[model samples]
Target chain A: MISKINLAFSQCKKENRPALLTYTVAGDNTKKKSLEILNAIAPYVDILEIGIPHNTPVADGGQIQTSAYRAIKNGIKVKDIFKIVKQFKKNNLNKPVILMGYYNTIFQLGERSFLKHCKRSDVDGLIVVDLPWPENKNFANKCKKQSINFIQLLSPTTSDIRMKNIIKDSHDMVYYISMLSTTGGRLKVSAKEILKNYNKIKKINPKQNVVIGFGITEKTISSLTKADGLVVGSALCKTISGALSRGTNPVRTAENMVKKLRSKII
Target chain B: MLKLKKGVLLIDQHDKNYMYGGKFGGNFIPETLKKPIEDLTNLFGRLRYDKNFIKERDYYFKNYVGAPTPFIKLENLTKHLGGAQVYAKVVSKANGGAHKIYNAVVHALICKRAGKKYIVGDTGAGYAGKMLSMAAKKFGLKCKIFMGAKDIKRQKPNCDAMRKNGAEIVPVYSGSQTLVDAVSECMRYWVSNCDTTHMAVGSTVGPNIFIKICAWSTAQISRELIVQLKEEFGGVPKKLKLINCVGGGSSAAGFWNEFIDYNKSQVELIGVEAGGPKNSKLHAAPLTFGSKIGILHGAAQYVIQDKDGQIGETSSISAGLDYPGISPLHCFLKDTKRARYTSASDEEALQAYKLVSKLEDLSPSLEPSHAFAEAIKIAPKLSKDTIICVNSCGDAKKDRAIITKRLGFFR
Candidate 1:
């Protein structure tokens, strides 16, 4: 199993480089529009965490939910998302793509089918919010066979024993949820607290790369430096929603947000 | 030529009610959970015919809620209004006062057997939660039910039932503050806490196990009708027509099992969804009108969802018929055109409910009123000798005041 923090360290060959991960729900607003947003974001980010829309996204806050709902309404499915990843690969967008969502969609699609899709779609990893360690052992084996990374999340509520188990079971970078509540709830939790948690996890699994997510806005990206990567979801989704509502160019708007996040993370 | 063991479980091919749906009915849950859901589903199937499960279920039905509910044959109003002879299937006979317990008992048992101590569910009517709680208590399990804060007042009787069963009701004040929000909240809770707790889904939208369990429970109506018709008439009717109301499409699936294979026995299955035209557009008439195949709860099926994949409105008079999606089996049934689908307005269902109560002294839950109203339309078209079966899914002793008040017989 790959430690998330170590994975981040291995990927960071460039000097003074901070990995800026851009998050977007596949086929948000419209498939074409979402594609445009992805293309616009391609130049700025290191990895793309594409959100697969499920009816119930428990871990997500309002903004990601809205984006996911839009994507689902636009007739997006797992196959469609895989197509997006394939297109990304065809374009030589070698930046690793991670598909993130609830496990129901994954389970419904079947574990073997999902891992196959990840492989065929050029998806590098998975971050199923509900698939905690030990429970994911069976799926992790399938992912291993498919050469797809099975990512796990370590929450603040997770005990040291559970953390060690999660770290051991994970095959990709550890996605440390920066907050206790759903995504986009609020930004009350500071970067120091996130970093403190990240450092403790890193000590146990020194080989893993740590990425902080949930409520990591553009303004707060700079404060989250202790981690190898910063994942911004709700803010990106909010920008996409605002752009669509205002009839503004979503690509430019997304690009602008990505630029701002990059500056902050750097 | 076929080697069949004496006790070997074999799906009845000759039974017109069999729903293979071409390999879709098989269980797809984890191998560990496969046996429980399968056993529960099989028990549900056998319960309709098995003397014991039925005896236990009927004991609760007759003594706790009251049973052998009268089938109220519609009066002159249906004829005067150019409608069919509607008959109400009084389901208010089930304890906890709704049609939810028909399958909730099996879910509770499966959970308890799996060493699950706590049971959590989302509810608007609180019927599922209450019935689940009652079942959990009987099986010695702890239960917690999630309800939308706004619905706690409207569905007070259901809440009382839950509390009576020693269940803790968690009020959710999330988005929409209704069944959808409650579902979302409950799903979140389950994902975070599926270790010792088995999330008892309210309807047939989760896994194939749920569909099988519900289908088994509902298949009882058909089995009972087989015996009842043989005794009532000289023989069973050649053509079987079954109707029931659908919310998350559980009860309808249960009753519709007898009519699944249209090619063989020529059984007609009709499911009536709630048509709340006077209400908001968020009503649960997805199969009959608005819907697309999307994942909800845990399965891929038709759902009324907004742009953000959040749950939407499902309008119906019966509290039991107020959910956004139908089961996947219903989807396949619709796709294959094996079953006919329709909807009854709230006014039509209410009128049917009143007619049943006044004429036969039988009170039915609002859910079955949809089927009752549809039966009114369908009965006239059939031969006078034709026998039509409507699942009296629930009885409405609690809704006596509402039914009477709606009829303008009381102040």
Candidate 2:
């Protein structure tokens, strides 16, 4: 079966525009609010990434970390994430949904059981931030066996040799971290610098879809849309958190933000 | 001169291969830390086996840190036990008052060579921090130690000692307010300051490269024990049992590294964990009781956690042993059945602490008191010909206040 992720990338290629990928922590603020927000923005985004709130997201900056803390405070559990993914898939089958988080959550849930839940819930892909390539080959193979796309991550510090080794495995897409800093930090590298590294990776495996993430916001999305996709995580999460703190309806706010971001991609 | 292996130096390969099996070890750092950890891993892999580095380390060990510490027979305790012939490797005789100075000096040397002016680390009982601070002072490097807020209260003297040695202490107030939380805080701090700082990991925990470096540096303890045993027993003991307390498992790794490759049937390696209280919902014995495998401090290991996979709280009278996780090396050893892991309750440890003091006129830190408690339990059942050697890795002077309070003498 062709994965939903591959189909989304193909759709973006046909449209001649970079895929607009947006992320939010599942069960953030409240379960009802989080699901409503995701459902509201599902149509505008080419792909949707839902973070499985973990207590220790060491790779994330202050923004995503706080979002996760709030989600957990509202009593979000792994079962709740699976339920949200199932509901999202049912509501929007055209848009692919990927579960992104640390490996400890999966390890805690048992690898086979977690993958089984992912498959049953129609989770299209997985982006484990901490489980890097080759070190997580076993888990990736399990995901592949279950027909779930295990997205690979390539950072600026990844060596050319290591990149070749990493891309040898099949993946639906590769996430290229734009800078060495965490998710919410300011981008120190210019678009030209990111494009240079992105071109190097494209040279190694031109067929693999590449998405630029980390420090991407609405203001910076126009410059980064030259890649196959752009991931706006911390920026979107910060928006939802900021709106909720002010007693505003975050669902409508996030929907408008996604529409604005998607409009800029053209 | 140590002969260099004649070939292209294999670089950046062991991060995946350094664990017990190729399946265990690898760098799982955040993207922000990839470059620095890679560089440190490469430098450590090269320097740990380099003959010149070894010579420099040995010179520092002999002249500066006073290594090759005496392995005493413990004749009085052995006779009192009336079963196994007992021995203790007196690591307390080393400078900085414990065996931690060995790894501290080696890591400080690495930092100096790499042109890093500052070293950062997390400590449980403050012994490792004090030792590192002393080494940093000697090597002209600034030091910062992140300690748990709870541990600071228990180990006040050692905290004072670390500060006296010119180290800045950062109190951690995260999960459990203990060593596990301190480790998490330290990792976060290192991620931001990795450019000008080197992490002096206090134990054989964290990432694979750090574990390998600590174990290699500390293997000097087992090496000296081997030579001492050879002279005392006319050869290595026929039936040798090695024991040490396990926190993040530095002492056990150091004590058992040399003998792991020996005949499995003839050697027995034991790791003792802190069993805080019997029925009070407090204990740090993850290996003995924990059934879950989780990631903490960048390494995959057995962790004391709840059903939801949240890391649970841990406690021990000895701050060093009060951790929620064990080193991946210990987990591997336990899984492979190469070592036995047991626990001693706070009551048992307290009794053992007083017994060792009364029997041998030597006061042992509560960390090693766990091992001594286990040794006292098993030694009586063994035959007289069998020999058991325990690594007395710390002194008891730092635990005076806590011990006195626990004994009801402070009121």
Candidate 3:
């Protein structure tokens, strides 16, 4: 029973490249434009991560915040997000789709109901920014029951003891927050420093799929290609924001940006 | 927990595993914060019983914070109400003119002990920021205070005072630009620089470690009150009601810390939240309104959020009481039926401020005026032997502009 998420990582590992992951708000510009953007970027991206727009995304930086705010203003509902995922899964190639958000949205939907939606929409993974280890154990178990990969996170500040606990409970993949900052923060710590820490986590369990996220822009993505996977969120979100301001379709711009990111990581 | 020479208990003996207890107050922060949070938890746990730390804390509480703040009987208000005897534990006598400095002092000292030179904090009405700035200046640590842009304008004097105390003020302009956003931004900033910085959370509404730290530090108020009660009434009186305003529940936590173990028949605790404007639909009374359980900032508690779980916009004339969430301790207390929760509307709080000023010749900050309003409402219904003690948690000087604009007298 190999999950699409695991398959993506395995395929990338076989190809000697890190899996390319892209994150965008579910209804960033509009309902239709979001679907178009997802479709346009699907070819280059190994894993497509959709953000559930929350009013207060404290963990997210300005670019992702703006995308979330736009989707929220458009009155995008949770069911609407599931619909988008279902449509994207139906119309596109079989790439893994991971829904990333804070825990409250899932709490609002109830763990069972939210997992049901995820299962129906063919969502392969979930990355709840707020639900870290220990507290997330119950929800992670619930996510497992639905066969969805509940991605656990590890940060540089995470001690080896806690890192072991998180990795043990992690599903198919684990997300390594590159630094101790919100998404889209400056690269305060150099790539060498981040990878040094990443390599330690890797040494703890080499077989586990670990992806590096946060501050993964074009300039930095190439430097991070040694990791199992790379997540580019704010950069692609900034592309969408730029396209909207210039009165252009974000689909092509997002596609091109993902292609560029894929080029670097692969 | 040590009982210090100044007749104060450092921490509650029964508060075992206060960080994540009984379905509330877990550390729900990002993994980047796990190290600092755990480090703080361990340090605070060790310092609670340390004799040297207790002595140093009491030294500041007595001389710097002006502790054992006058427990003055409100004779006029008691006679006017014609039922219960009223008293106020004047926490405004504390340094920074609010109970906030209690937490600020402990956090600054903790930062100093942790060997960090930078301390960050968040403020809604600027009390925590002002207090943190003063404490940081005293401790020779660089201070950064995150405040909402909306608060920066209304709480200008406090902001100016923070600047005077040499603290850098970071204005958070996102998501209603109020206390909640300030806290969010402060936590966001801490995620990056936590290795060398200590985040002095303004209230007991954040992560598990912060909630416990705030509750433990602010418990100094109750340590003072326990002795004051015996001094005032010769002993603990029958039908004692302890009231304090509940925003993030710091003042109330401090006010009722010792009384938590008291029998329900002996002591009644009341927490008054902001009920917003009288005719409007918005309010900050989450616990009173039976807000659905949801996670906000870093803990799971009763929060005002939509069915979709988006944190709702909250409003109150007092910026301090305008947060959408409350302390997890209060949440636990409310569930256990150990305390009563209520709300005071903006109009009622303003009216209480006017009445108390005319009668007591002492004005309270809008935050505590809500508690006073609750006391005023229930005083007439009780017996003459019933004693009502309200923690006048802050001075009214901070609300001069809003008071002048609303009721036309604070100028």
Candidate 4:
């Protein structure tokens, strides 16, 4: 059976447009506000990637890091993240929810137990930022045991040989880092250059659903529509932070921002 | 050189294969970092076995680093302690005034060989930054040193030396504003410039390749010590105690590398960690306190974290040893019962610093003072025939401000 995540991507592929993936820190501001925000933006979002806020996120840029900090300060726990995903799934079953985070959190919670929580909470997929391929083989197999998609990652720095190995080992989806940067960095390379790299990765395993992430904003989203999917994390997070500071409701602000991002790709 | 048990865990193993113990280390890194790290792993694997590399490295060790630093029996310290005969490897006399220079010089050599023109490093107490700056200048490579903003305020002397060596200082103002933040920021910066810059990781932490590189680099300390040991005892001593302070565990890893294979009856290793200030719950003693296994940077090892797995901020009187995580190799040793680890409080470390200064006329940084304190405690238990050698890995001048603030005017 095709996973819900694969079905979402297939639907987008059939529609001749890139799937719109949005990332937000779970329990940002407050649990109620975070759930409301997820529901508010669920219409435009194809797959929801919720960050399990980490205090020391080496890969996150400043914008997403701020979102995570707020969530952590508001007393977000691993169980709280599952609650948010569960609440969102209760209302919207078709949209896939993927937890993107560092590996320490899951290791702290027993890996098997955490997957049990994922299954119970209806979490469709997982993207452990630090658990790359080969090292992830055991965990990925464990993830597969529960019928969850364990997202693999590729980068511009990844060699052709290693890319093929990674693609072969990957589940249904692969997260292609469009450039050599953390979450919120500006476009150091052109959008055209990003797609060229994206196309090269696509050629390796054309059947695999590859998504482009990092440096993806409204302006760059349309240019990257050639890919299967695009991930907008920092941009939406920046909106949440920017809105809260300006005394605006973050849920409404994020809904509008994600909707605008969705308008571009479709 | 003492032959190591190659391929037992990561000892003598430098191929793309990584780890200290079988389960303690692996390259769990982003895809962007994978290629550069693998390239580094391959480069080190080939270069470590090449005799030419060793010759060129030692050429600098002799001329540039002023190595073969004095290993002397501390008669005054021995008399003051009144039990075991105490000895010390005087690393403060080495260039850049610390054992950190050993890894710094080797990393500079690596950066040059990789065809990279620039090198970047993260520093806590400024010793790593200063040492790498000095080596980068000698190798004619551009250098950038990431330091915590708070460290810049306290460790002025070493920071000044880093600047004088023509390296750019990137002040990190992130969480905890210390070594941990500096390292994270340094890694973030490397993600952008990895094509041209080789990150000279300051300690035996981070990814598996870095742990291996740092272990290989700092192994020079033991390389020289073994020859000195033969000269001191006319052969290697069986009843010897090897002690050093373990922050990120580079110096201790080097000091104990050749001795790991030795039976506990022959060479017993003790590692000292920062116990923080008295009456304060904070500390840098992950291995001493039984921290759980978690991934920090790239390697899965023992780390101090909250109930939610967030890396906790650690406090130490000495900036050098102020870290919440320990080397994977140290964690392995601790679990295997091959080595013992203990903590020295800030008060005890300060007292040890003053005692060593007064008795031996040698001042040590608070980082090594922790080791000295541990040695002082264990010496009374051991007999006079036993030998206890401490790796006095750094100087005290950079710690003058903290020393003066805590202890008042010293006679």
Cα displacement (angstroms), candidate 4, residue A20, comes to: 0.7
TM-score of each: 0.65, 0.87, 0.96, 0.97
List lDDT for all candidates, in order: 0.68, 0.84, 0.89, 0.88
Error of 4 at B346 (Å): 0.5
Best by DockQ: 4
Q: Tens digit of lDDT per residue, candidate 3, span B1-411? A: 221122333223223333323456666778888788889988988987799999998998888888878888999999999999999999998888999999999999999999999999999989999999999999899999999999999988899999999999999988899999999889889988899899999998788778778888888888888899998788888789999999999989889988877777889999999999999889999999999988898888899999999999899999999999998888877876878999999999999999999899688999999999999999999999999999999998989989999988872
Question: Any runs in candidate 1 off by more than 4 Å, and if so which?
Answer: A1-9, A13-55, A58-266, B1-88, B258-266, B278-282, B305-313, B397-411
Greater DockQ among 2 and 4 belongs to 4
Taking the tens digit of each residue's C-alpha lDDT, what string does model 1 give over B1-411? Answer: 112122312233211222234322332222123233444456556555767756776665456444444444445434543433444444555566655776677666556556678888877666778888888887788889998886786667778888988999999765556776676777666544555567767776565555556555545555555555566555645665678787777777655554454342446778888887455565667788857655565455677765434456565555666777777777766766667788888888887777655655555667777887887777767765455667777656444455566677521
Worst ten in a row by lDDT for model 3 chain B: B1-10
* Clash-forming residue pairs, model 4: none
DockQ of 2: 0.32
Cα error, residue B302 of model 1, in Å, equals 2.6
- Over all chains combined, what TM-score does candidate 3 have? 0.96
DockQ of 4: 0.75
Ten-residue region with minimum lDDT total, candidate 2 chain B: B1-10
- What is every candidate's C-alpha DockQ against the true complex, given to 2 decimals? 0.15, 0.32, 0.73, 0.75
Question: What's the CA RMSD for each of the models?
Answer: 8.3, 4.8, 3.2, 2.3
Model 1: lDDT of residue B260: 56
Q: Write the per-residue lDDT of candidate 2 for residues B174-252, one digit (tens) a residue.
A: 5466787777767777766677789988888887767877877788898898889889988878888988999888888
